[model samples]
Target: MDVYYFTEFPYAEFPESEAEKFPSMRLTFPNTYFDPNKAHDLFKRYLDEYQHAEDVGFDGLMINEHHNTPSCMDVEVNITGGILARTTSKAKILMLGNMLPTSDNPPRLAEEIAMLDVISGGRIVSGFVRGIGIESWANNTNPVYNRERFEECHDLIIKAWTTPGPFRWEGKHYQYRAVNPWMLPIQKPHPPVWVPGTGSPETVEWAAKNRYTYAAFLTPLDVAQGLFARYREYAAADGWEAAPDNFAFMVCCHVNDTEEKAQEAGKAFLWRMNHPLRGPREYWSPPGYTSRAGAAAVAQRRPTPLNELSYEELQSRYHLVVGNPDSVTRQLRHIKDTLGVGALLLEAQGGPLSHHDTMRSLELMGREVIPALKD
Candidate 1:
């Protein structure tokens, strides 16, 4: 299995208690807490961390974007993707990814990703996402049109990459009279596409239909297994058998010299599990953002939220893994065996996880854990 290193590129220099003053630490959470100077230092440190992860032995580097949240400072993945493309030579740059629904221009989105792929020498995995409800509000996109826009934008971007453009696009959510762009991806049919989800049924079906990898982000192992099974069912119906490469599992993971030290450092993830996840139902799930069935699946998939779970509970459920190299490798291997996933996307850095701990974890993962799993 490919071991990919990931971080939200968090800007958590502010006190966690500040989130209590707002409805949630998301859309309405004031940016008055943001400090440009602190962020400047953090951006440098985080970029160094990404470069180091590649230097060690990680197969890929994963970066994501979010607006109006301290949990992820990277507001644009393509920009970061471009940086990683130039800085690192071996690791695949996975941008999980540009938000399709919120974007008004599919052709521009296509050009940006294509440019990154070109810069990266074809090592780009383009991950498309249906932005969370908070994203709909931040981008001022209608929640009701989220799915429609996502599909249409995705179709247009794919066409821009694959078909000989100069073609016209007329769709409900997007329209272009002349679709032609000089920038095209280095990868032949465009970079590989991956989609991340928690428990959305439609997302699984959609990913399976396109034969793109479906990454289950922070979902319980059992829940991920069920989602993968459903993907297989869809693929089987289409007369193709899905392989491990068709699926990926993402989780918070940390490794250290000892289990005790790892456990202590793992507490840093609680900052991410807590405030940022605390929000009203509407902020998290606008009325039309999710179908009734999708919502039901999500509710059933995670009866207890990550914030509500204790550290031990989180570890027991596989939402977070912390240990020495041997132990972490065992746990991650179990996940790989159980879900039959092709990749493990490990969030090595999260809310307030210090640079010392983060680098140590990455070093140990590269030195011991990753190789053990491969064996």
Candidate 2:
């Protein structure tokens, strides 16, 4: 499996208890807590870490975008992708990815991603996502139109990359009289498109139909198995076998010299499972954001909210892996074997994990854990 280093680039500089005052540490959370001077330092450190992950021999670097939350500082993956493209020489740049529904211009989105692919010498994996319910609130995008907009935007972007334009686009959520862009991806038929989900059936089906990779994020092993099985069933219906390359899995990961130190350092990840994920239901799932079936699938997929899981439970569930190099390697290998996935997206940095520990973990992953999994 190809191991990709990822970070939400969390800004956990404040008290976790403070989040209780808002619906969630997201859209409605007050910006009084934001200190730009601190954030300036954070951005620099996180970028440095990304470069280091590549230097240490990670196969890829995955970046994501979010809004109104300290959970993820990257508000625009394209901006980060541009920076990484210019700075890093190797490693796939997976942008998981532009929020199609929240974007107003599909052609612009296509151009920016194409530019990154060009800048990176074809090392780009374009991912499409339906922003979470909170994103609808954050961007003031109508929740009811989320899926529709996502599909339309995806169609337009794909056309912009594949069809030689000045082609006209007329769709339900978007329309363009002239669609032409000088920038095009280095990868023929555009860079590979991947889609992520927590086992949303529609998402799995859509991804399967398009033959795009389906990355299951933070779902338990069993839940991911079921989702991948569903994808296989979809592919079978179309008379083709889905390869392991068709699947990917993402989870929190940290490795140190010993399990004891790893556990201590891994505490930083707890904040990620807590405050940002803690919130009233209304804040997390606004009306119409999820279909009844999708919401039901999500509710049943996990036994409990991530914040409620003890560290041991988290490890047992494979939500997070913190251990010595050998142990971490074993756990990740089990995930690889159990899922038959081609990619492992490792969130090696999270919460307030110190720069020292983050770098150490990445170093160990490069030196030991990643290689073990490869064999």
Model 2 agreement with the true structure over 1-375: per-residue lDDT tens digits: 799999988888899889987778888788889999999999999999999999998999999999999899899999999999999999999999899999999999999999999989999999999988888889999988898999999999999999998999888889899999999999998899999998678999999999999999999999999999999999999999999999999999999999899999998888898878887787777888888999998898876999899988889999999999999999999999999999999999877899999999999999898888888
- Deviation of model 2 at 293, angstroms: 1.3
Segments of candidate 1 deviating more than 4 angstroms: none
Per-model clash counts, in order, read 0, 0
Error of 2 at 356 (Å): 0.5
Error of 1 at 241 (Å): 0.4
What is the TM-score (0 to 1) of candidate 2?
A: 0.99
The TM-scores of all predictions, comma-separated, are: 0.99, 0.99
Among all windows of ten consecutive residues in candidate 2, which has the lowest summed lDDT?
277-286
Worst 10 residues of 1 by lDDT: 9-18
Clash tally for model 1: 0
Q: What are the clashing pairs of model 1?
A: none
What is the lDDT, from 0 to 100, of the residue 211 in candidate 2?
Answer: 97
The collision pairs in model 2 are none
